[model samples]
Target chain A: MATLDINRVRKSYGSMEVLKEVNISIEDGEFLVLLGPSGCGKSTLLNIIAGLEDITGGDVLIGNRVVNDLPPKDRDIAMVFQSYALYPTMTVRQNIEFGMKIRGISAEERAKATKAAAEMLQMTGLLDRKPSQLSGGQRQRVAMGRAIVRHPELFLFDEPLSNLDAKLRVDMRTEIKRLHQRLGATIVYVTHDQIEAMTLATKVAVMKDGIVQHFGTPQEVYDRPANTYVARFVGSPAMNILRGRLVASDGPVTVAFETSDGEALVSGVPLSPESAARFRDREVLVGIRPEHFTMDTAGAVPLTVDMVEPTGPDTLVVFSAGGADVVARLDPLAISVGTKARFGVKAEKIVLFDPETETRLD
Target chain B: MATKSLARQRAMGQTFIYGVLALLALYYLTPLWVMITTSLKPLDEIYGGSFIGLPQTVTFEAWSKAWSGACIGTECTGLKPYFINSILMVVPAVLLSTGLGALNGYVLTKWRFRGANLVFGMMLFGCFLPYQAVILPMAQVLGKLGLSGTIPGLILVHTLYGICFTSLFFRNYFITIPDELTKAAQIDGAGFFRIFFSIMLPAALPIIVVSCIWQFTQVWNDFLFGVSFTSGSDSPITVALNNIVNVTTGRKQYNVDMASAMIAAIPTLLVYVTAGRYFVRGLTAGAVKG
Candidate 1:
């Protein structure tokens, strides 16, 4: 059974509506992530689920019961904040034990939970030290231990690793993934980092301008985004959005767009047959992930490389097509600035969106 | 040759700066010097000699008289009891006002409701009004409650006035604390008071120290409310100190009056000398981002 169901949730502050009617459901033990840029109402959704913020409309259900009126304590959930929010004066053991102590759990039970959580996060040695004495990563582990000791049915993470430096963020991301797998607890995490969304989420919901643009598996969102926004938002260097005309719609649809050198052609998966026929000869956007481009001597599209960015494993070639900069990931040895490179996007890799609405055509 | 002149020039500048600082210190300390010497002089020498001159013959008569035998209208029982009264009044006033202001500030910053800023502004408006402006109405209310001539009534007046400043202090300090702390506490299942005692209040130690010191100085030094609301044995040290200075019935005992003034000034001066570092910090702690 799904552990959480958000039905038609709408939030507004006065007349400024920050979230439109949004819906999502997370099955038991699934890691559901709300991903977006700032002001996309992702945190608002997280707060509403935690009962910290009231929703303007719609129902929030946890374990088949509406929790719209329940206080955060009554919801049987724990949250780790972006700031970690560890109590400044308390030691690590006391921090982890605080919630249980407040709930009137026996001292023996609290001690057992605290000990178990400390060992789980590998923070046993730092149990007696205050939060200010620990390093950033240790503080983050203490925050997680504070949440885990409660054994809540669900865990909420609000961009918990955002405060760390780069290398530490990556390490904590892996640690969080392992923790989830070990506990098999249902979790709903909110973050603006696409890489974190991609690496950790079993389900990713991409949000923008007060609405969820797409909700699907990470591969589904990355491979077949529902709109130009979702496609651009979920990938590093983002998906290349090329304005093109749908030249053919029969067996395999093809789009033709202008490159700096000349016109380029790309064969793509057809939209639904009924919709494909109507879009034939009409303007549409072709969304192609950077990794989908391949360098080939006989490739149909020729690109005049404006810039080359070498990123260790691969190099990204920046070129202009249809009045937009497009980035293509290529072998580090394959490309350089000011070179003429011919590239091909595989037929199955292109997704189509209506140019005016930015929505998927079918 | 160049290095020698440069060294000479640096020495000249340092001397010039220190010379100006010493002159300013002397200018500020001249009155304190006058008071100390006057308090040590015999009454006959004070009447016969230069005001700024050191006493030709020293005497301890005035310090003893000021502490034990000074007359304030009819009472010659001295300031000992009134000093205790000020301690009683100031302690409770400082504690109650600071406690209430912290709660007010926590609500104003974290558990905000509609028009919370407006409400805080209204409370802060109280800090700007001179206590004299509200005396008539406040005294009337105190009289109706039959608390007009009591230390508790005076404590009430000081607390009502002191809350405004303390509230502003806590609000500014607490706002720098991320709202995430409160949200995390709520998720931990702590209700209002629990979160305050365990989480927010512990982290507020610096601001709390600042608020208590600020409230103590204001209430301890207050005179207008003390004079207007209480009299006689029920009066605070400030009022009693005033009567001793301004209402001497016999010869104008300059040495005795100076001794009494010094006694009254000692507590506040001692407070500053001991915790002055914290006072400057408390004033400026939340102005910068944490």
Candidate 2:
């Protein structure tokens, strides 16, 4: 029954409305990642759920109880902050047991819980050391351990791994995923890193300017984004958004766009005939994931590669297409700079967005 | 030959620097030297013009007399009682002011609300307020409260004045502590005072030492408030020291005066010598890169 529902939450500071009527919910044990750029109100929404910040309007429900007026202490939750927020003076053991101590739990119980949490995080040797003595990754584990001991129904993480180096971030990311799987705890994690959102979240809420742009499972958001913003924001190298026109053919409707070389057409777009009729002969936006382009010699479109970026396993080919600098992830040695290449767009992978609204079509 | 000349040049530079430092040390130590030497000499030796030199006859008589026998304006009691009075006043005043200032800093930085800036601005303005400006109104209030010419009245005045600077010190230091710490504590089920005692106060040890040293020295050495507020037997050491130096009997007792002055100055000196390192450390601790 553990769940979080943010119902019609509206937040504003003075006359500046930071979050409009936004709503998102996650089932029990689902890892919900509120993903957005800085100042996009993702952190604000997380703070609201944690009861750290007062919501300007609407309700926050945790485990079927409205916690709008509950203090953070009474909200039955634990949070891991980006800075770790470990008590600088307390040892790791004391930091983990502090909440239990505050609630007047027995000393024996506190010791047992601290020991279990420390062992789970593999930091039992660091229990007696102060926060100042630990390195960044160790501090991050201590923070997670502190949250783990509480055994709260909900866990809130506010970009907990942003402080670590790239190598340590991946290691800790896997550690967090493992912890989530073992504990089966409902978690609401916030990060601007799309990779973290894609990898860690069971459900991802892509946000912009305080509004939820997309809310779905990781695969769902990647496969069928709700809008252009979500499509571009949720993927690396971002899904290429091309401005093109739709044509009504004897069979199915096709989107015709221009590559660097010449005109191209992609059919089999997932649109009904009735909806396709309205967009016929009208300019629309075509959303294509960078990986969906195939290198075929006798393909429909010809692309002139302007630059090639080889990142070990895969090569990123950048070409001017659909009035934008479009990037296509391809196999290494497949393309090089200053070369005109032919490619095929997987027609079934094409998504059409309304040019004016920037929303995905049917 | 080149290395030899370079070594010689470095030696010469070291000698020059040490020579200036030695001269400056002697210059500053001259008055203290005279005071100590004068306090050790007998009255007859001071009168016989062995003032700046070693005493012709060394004696503990003046030291004992200054400690237990000197009179301050008809009061036969020495600086002993007054020193006790200063301790009594300075201890409580320093504690109250420092504790209140830490609380002020905690609230201003962490538990912010509307007009918190204005309140902090007003407290900061209190720091620049001259002691003389508040003397009249303070005296009137003390008189109405029936606390005029009392040690508690002086403590009250010093604590109120000390809060301004101590608050400024603590607020600036506590501002460097991230707000996330306080929020984390709140989620951990700790209440306001619990968070303050467990998290804020433990982390504030350096700043607390800084405030204690500053307030102790200021309140202990304060003469204007000490003199204007208290009278006669209830006066602090500064006032008693002034009375002993100014009594001016048939022939001035320079030895007793100097001894009394040194006795009054030792506590502040001891305070500085003991905790001086933390003062510099606390001032720069907050400047660490975030």
Candidate 3:
């Protein structure tokens, strides 16, 4: 296992730049997830790390050695494509042993390695079956088996679970996590699914428009996104950014905004002393996660429930506030639409952004 | 009564379809039937009264004479040596063209470079070029290379021509295979030819059969190239059969001619009979979805 570092990486096609100067580094055995929507160049970054695509400018160092000019095989990386990419005609054993065969490994050693990989993947019975004969999950296991047999220093996964059904995707996600812990190999996994990133990654790089919007631990990215783009992209039902005026008085700081009723005030707003002094009475965007809004009877804000969605575990209540729609995840309470309810924001969880720049204020 | 009439109508539709298919099959098989029957007949029987009928005395004499004794343009050598020549020419030609075409298809689709489409477009344009257009220049090239009237020259000409179709077949076939497979192979340390042999060629069984059968039929049944490029004893079986049939001196040996035609046609017939099942289905199946 080896640490991977990408320094000032940029990719372009003539005049069209896909990846702007992006830098990210991960320690050995840390799972780094490049998360973004389609065309956001997350997969391009993964391919750049794999040496499958050339970078316009930068260095990708594996084990602290610059490997920018090495071929994919020479870089000691194994990739699991989104399609699994198992050799269709070969059986599971042959697919696992193919790399060793190409490298001229001895037959007995290849077979032993194949057997160990198949056993680890719990697919020993499928060793003789071709890829077409295997189910989607089995094919994914075989792909993993192929990569495991290579024993490369780094593993690359390009949305490997995207092709599976929802239930299979969940199972394979856990399976991949288990494999990562067991193998302890450095991995760069690319996915658009934020939950996969949240569950599987030690470090998450939320990308937008070829730029790294946020690069930190998943909780850090989730609880404290760097900007509005990441604030909305990393969460389900998304964080609601409501326009409001910040008021810093002698007692405490509070944000007041227009509610369905006259005006609503969220007091005890958390901010640094410098931010409190600088933005004492300035316009700001208040960011509140869905789960951070609680049903408080004595809260100052009154919101009319516009829509309700019950996702079995929690209820999502949509309301209009500060001239934008807001979603609040509440307990499965028997709340009806069009009802005026008072909700309070958790002070510690609230993030304030500068209204002009849409960046975090503190 | 309604159900009975419906059943009867369905039976009638089936009968009509079978009737038309049977008539078409018989229409196509008539020449083959006549060839088999006339080849079994003695020359005297064919000349006298039983031109299209079963021979009064079926004999192997005509078949044996057609095999080893018939004269063609005063060489008096039978179609045997020419049949061997055609075999020598067709096998290598089919193999080489198919191999080259497979390589071309792999490169055009997988290991692509700049101007790949232009190169493939030029090859596709070569597919529609008339055979007569290239014969003069090809003959000149053959003469310049000291391969004029040789079996190897014919092999070279057929191989060069066959690459267009074979590459077309293989490129279309290989394109259906996902690019991820080769990329995965590359990461697995397999080089260019390693991926071709291990991944591509194995998946290419159906297309290989298709290319071989097509090239074999085209090269085997070609009369113009065989006749124009070679003469006398060095000719392929088609030219030798033409020599056997177009005699200017004596009565036409219709039985020997029929037997020689059947002999020359048997290889392609066997090729089709054995490999035709894969022709339609093989091109569209394998290597992508599941």
Candidate 1 stretches with Cα past 4 Å from truth are: A334-336, B48-59
Q: Scored by Cα lDDT, where does model 3 land?
A: 0.91
Tell me which residue pairs clash in candidate 3: none
Can you give the DockQ of every candidate in the order shown? 0.86, 0.90, 0.77
Candidate 1 lDDT over B1-290, as tens digits, reads 99999999999999999999999999999989988999888888888866799988889888888888888889897778888999999999999999988999999999999999999999989989987899999999999989999988988898889889989988988898899989988988999999888887887877888888888888888888989999889988889889998997667889988888888888888877888888787667677545
Tens digits of per-residue lDDT for model 3 on A161-268? 999999999999999999999999999999999999999999999998999999999999999889998899988989998888888664457988887766888888
Q: Candidate 2: how many backbone clashes?
A: 0
Give per-residue CA lDDT, model 2, range A134-185, as digits (tens).
9999999999998988899899999999999999999999999999999999
Find the 10 residues in a row with the least total lDDT in model 1 chain B: B281-290
For model 1, how does the per-residue alpha-carbon lDDT over A320-343 read when each residue is reduced to its tens digit?
Answer: 998899998888865558988788
lDDT of each: 0.89, 0.91, 0.91
lDDT of 2: 0.91
Q: What is the lDDT of residue A317 in candidate 2?
A: 86
TM-scores vs. true structure, each candidate: 0.96, 0.98, 0.96
Q: What is the interface RMSD of each candidate, in Å?
A: 0.6, 0.5, 0.7
